[model samples]
Target: MSSSGTGGSDYDVVISGASLAGSAAAILLARQGARVALLERRSDPEAYKVLCTHSLTACASPVLAELGLIPALEKAGAVRNEGRWYTRWGWIEPWAGPAGAELPYGYNIRRSTLDPLIRARAAQTPGVDLLLGHRVTGLVREAGRAHGVRAQTAEGEREIRARLVVGADGKDSEVAKLAALPVRRHDNGRFGYLAHFRNLPLRDGISHAWFLEPDMAYAFPNDDGVTVVAVLPDKKRLPAFKEDLEGSFSAFLRALPEAPDIDSAERITKITGTVDYPLLSRKPTAPGLALIGDAALTADPLWGVGCGWALQSASWLARAVGPAATGQGDLDASLTAYARTHRRRLRGHQYLAVDYAASRPFNPVERLVFSAAARDASVARHMHLFASRLIGPSRFLSPAALAKAAVVNLKHRRAAAR
Candidate 1:
């Protein structure tokens, strides 16, 4: 690793932001013997991102295992959420275990616990230089290609140069701003609020979500017997929530049919919320720069895909750029591969998530699928696979699955008529 000195071109990659994506990227690159500088604004390793629903879907299991995080997470009491139940048409429970016997279960743990774990692990990696309390001030560009960053640390200003600069900084990324990357944003019409509760009367191993038409609520059983309960209501309902945040929050949860007995649970944290969560998508790469995680794409948080995608995108970026970062391939081609891979894997998912962020009621196709899942065990399993993100949207909406969903719904309708 290169020393943080003036105009020092030290590392192979300078990754901004030491959150999930940044830290994960650092670890992966370092493991491949690429020198990495992982920078974070926060000095404390234990400090974590507070305003997030820190749920990781089954899709991230492999990445977590690769990073060697599962054992530590389990040791810290993180709950293994075997499956999710949706209250769309009715209580739609998928298969009772993991996505498959081979797949590891999804997990729910507070970011307070998760972020620090990832950061610490990354810091321990051999070729990684973890720079805490380093705030990026500007991009160091040469001939229109990003090569490094200008950052302000406690000692003084320093310039760290690299073959590649990764903007894992986040949605409001300084690198993205400096690079002037084209961004496409989608407006979100719903406001989200959540808090942690102790001893919530929910099933121990299952995460539950209620799709109450234009509104949504969830209760995820997490580490230490704490459940994270969140509600996303259309902006039109903001007045009621603002009038009485706790009362309204409780009322909303109680209003969900067959909801958990949240009112009976002990509230452990203050209610926190955000009204502006616009979905953001950006071009993932440029000549010498790449964006990963939320810097590349941010969708509605209601789906709890943020944490999972953060780790997944970092893994994708690492795999795509491994050869180049380790000095065996064309850097530009590797970045282009990463960009294409990012879009191919996440674009469709983001589109659907952003569309739902509009806070509109479910359309005909959603109704058909949800109704079928609620009625048929086989359909429920398929829906679970999609919801868990073990399969892509294309696979979930395949001809065979669609036909089965239609048949399941048709049979239910005919049986009801009788």
Candidate 2:
């Protein structure tokens, strides 16, 4: 990164993939007075990621609010969701916090709706140039640091120069690949199938998750009276899905306890699935560049963490590098700060998520805690906090929390003797 004034740059920051993370980062950085170029490979502003659950967790609520997106999202018919989970033991209901405090709720909207809305916001924000049909071809590097990107546009090719480059692209990131960032790969043992339904009567404004040992399923009620039903069954179940995609998917959901009535609901979208989803974590930063969203880390999609983390990571990147990108501070130090923040906030969560993606049964600790949470509202509140990404495992597994869980389980066991 340049160590002095930002006079020689076409822009202060050039962000690749003007989707959730890129647009959020561009809006945030430009708000802080940095000139930003937001590039998207797709020409249509309406293009969206189809292979997503689009369930933003509670942790991302504040960032959306900060971006002034709450009203727009609501106006666009996005659903607000508090979460409920069913385990082998029982249901862990969404708990109201102490003293009648409401739990944080997240948005449940399809990427088809969210992607274009967020991108439009970025385009409307001052200081951000939203470039569509701009596919990143190569990184502009000097002295072992990325300075910008070479992009293929509607016209001829162009070289976009900036003081700092940002990769907010998805898992198969061209920027991360071009930067030669080290990546660790972890394969998922289970596969997923997803579709939308109309008139599927899920609980109003609630997202339901069933952790049926090695398998998982969800019913997310989304915008415009539509509901999303998905299943992530172990590989052994793949044969059934392969035989009949719609039948197998409906069967999986219908078999769950308190399952929605799929028979009565209208299937709104064709069944879409992937058998080989994997976890990928890339080194998030180099000398003059930083990566955000799935480019930084891709966790198992079953957990529904991608959209939430995209907004959070974009916020963190903007906060860390805003001054430096505007030529008011050292870019290297800013990049380091962004990297540290990314790892600190997400590494622990990713470790646990990757372990679960193996399609293994829950370990002893998880069994104890989850069972206890189903029986006790206090325990459930803490569990929701942790699962929603508002709190990390350290706090969720704190000595006091575990001790309380043990007591709750003991009391349940004693009562069962009657």
Candidate 3:
């Protein structure tokens, strides 16, 4: 429980949100010898995002390991997944190829279970103060430069003066709103429902996701015999679902042939749905302020990209801004670099997610590739790498791969045409 009393310019950085990105920034900066004040709106350490499925793709595994969090996560009972994808055409199992050629994998855990653990770790780190129940009221700017943040806690109003302010407040970020940064938003007319279950059958440590026509469903096994189930459908179907939520969700799950393995599992929590408009962010930085996690960009959750990006963005921001905060470079220059690097690394993934969000059923190109994967083990391995986010779309569209897909598709069409 390392912390400091209010009313001091001793801290170098003041983070507005103390969840994933905020706490991560605090930890990283503090480890770099910068004093930090981490502010969390909720007083309870247990308070966290409940609507998340908490799945991370392979891209973020190294980032977490670099933060020295993998050991803590393992100790907290996180599970590594080899990845499993199920589609109407067929199931794409984990690639059993050479480990070196195979893409590195990621893991899944409950956010409610992971957040408190991270916050606790942040509190233990030297030079970091974990302030709970503190809500940011406004930004403190002088001559268009962020100097600090004004927050209200049970102790009344207080100001944290620091070299920088970090916003990890989530998709609907209050700091982003207050700062008046232009947020680019694209909606897919979709919504997501998530809940947890206990018991029932699932391959140990493997996660399952079903691509059902226009609908998407995922089942993630977490620690303590708990599994998270989520369903995402076009928003137009929400009205009927509202009338009978539980039944609607159950029916939706049952409708997916591949979802039954998860549906047959025990229900430990009531099903819940989120119809909030999914928003994607473009610029995540200001002169002396920066946004991280979903606060920076919220992609279509159908890909389960948020948790991983939160960690990745936090790590990237920490690296980009640490020197500036330490007075080695221009703050604005650092902020610009952070925004550019983030876009460069994440734009491809976001593009793919957005394209898939369109209401159209599987496109012809996707059908051809997936059909080939269903028939050939080599193709399935490639699709596994592509779907797991180990490789980009272009890599999967190489001349040889496309030629193979075309041949496989012709055979399937001939069999059906006959």
Candidate 4:
């Protein structure tokens, strides 16, 4: 809570906003023997953003496994999920085709439960100095290089110096703000309202996503006897939703034919809503500062990929830049490497999420696939795996598979036309 001088605290890395991404980075950097100063604005360690749908796709499992957080996640009572999607045409079964691997998939770990767990683990790690309640108000730039950050504490303002500054401060990142990173924003013309419930007819350990034409809904079974449901609809509908939160939410749930009937289901938490704002990859790194998680890029949450991507990207940033910050490589090269890797790994997925967020009722390719799935069970299974992020998009849309889907769809169309 005190500032000694212009330069201080011989830390290797200073991480702003100690949420999931920041905490994960701190843990990994500390594990690599780098002293990390984690500065969080909130005094309360339990304080966290609650508007998220709280679902982690299987794509992030490998990263979690590598970080040794998988065991901790399981111990914290994460629920395993492998479920079917109810589309307008029919039920799309889980992918078990020749193209997709058969594996038990995914989890619905609530951030309220998972965030504190990861943060606590990060605090216990050897090289991390967790500085709670200190708000990073400015960046310290000397010779056009970020040496550290200036944070306002309870007593006064203090300058914390480090070799590198990592911004895991989420979508509206302050570090990114100070660095003047370029950002491209996309308005998806929709908003989301999410909350938890009890006594909903949720399949045990399985999550369900309903892909309605213009609107969407999802239910994730999580720890503490709670399940999360989010309603994503066009922004024009917000007024009605805002007028009566509970009634609008119930109506939205009932409108989704694929969703389970939750009209009479008891609410576990207050309904939360967020205006639709989709963010793509911004300038992730510059000199000695780098952005991780939503601060770097944020896709549509209809796919439930945000949390997984955050943890995964944080791990990637740590691995890519920690060594350089500790003098293992050129700091610029390390930051560039992290930026490149994050973009390469996530670009395709983000593009796909954006395409889906447009609210167009099934493009031609999707029509063929869904039509095929309605007629052929095998096709539905593959569609299921693809949606779950279990397989790459290329594999899901392979020429051979597309041809098979076309054949099946043609036959169904003829049958219906007759």
CA RMSD, predictions in order: 3.0, 1.4, 4.0, 3.9
Put down candidate 4 lDDT per residue, 1-418, tens digits, no spaces.
1111223447889999887888988998888878999988998877776878677777778767766788887888888766667777776666435665675466778888887877888888999999998999998887787889999999899999988888988888888989999987766767898888876786544777777777778888888768888888877677888888889888888777646657667787888778757756688998788998899998787777788788888888888877676766677878888989887877777777778777767888887887687678678777766666667678888998899999998787798899
After superposition, which runs of candidate 4 have C-alpha atoms over 4 Å from their true positions? 1-9, 95-101, 203-205, 373-381, 390-392, 411-418
lDDT of each: 0.85, 0.91, 0.79, 0.80
Candidate 3 residue-wise lDDT, 200-236, digit = tens: 4665457778877687788888877788888888777
* Structural similarity to truth (TM-score) of each candidate: 0.95, 0.97, 0.91, 0.91
Best by lDDT: 2
Give candidate 2 misplaced runs (Cα > 4 Å): 1-6, 96-99
Candidate 1 residue runs with Cα over 4 Å from true position: 1-8, 96-104
TM-score of 1: 0.95
Q: What is the lDDT of residue 162 in candidate 2?
A: 93
Clashes of 1: 0
Q: Any runs in candidate 3 off by more than 4 Å, and if so which?
A: 1-10, 98-103, 203-205, 261-264, 393-404, 407-418
Q: On residues 1-418, what C-alpha lDDT tens digit does candidate 1 reach at each position?
A: 1121223458889999999999999999989878999999888988788778779888888999999999999998898766555655677777643555443467899988898889999999999999999999998887788778999999999999888899998889888988999999999989999999998887655788888778888888888889898999999989878998889998888887777887788999999989888999999999888999899998788888888899999999999887687566788888888889889989999889988888988887788888888888778778777777788889888888889999998888899899
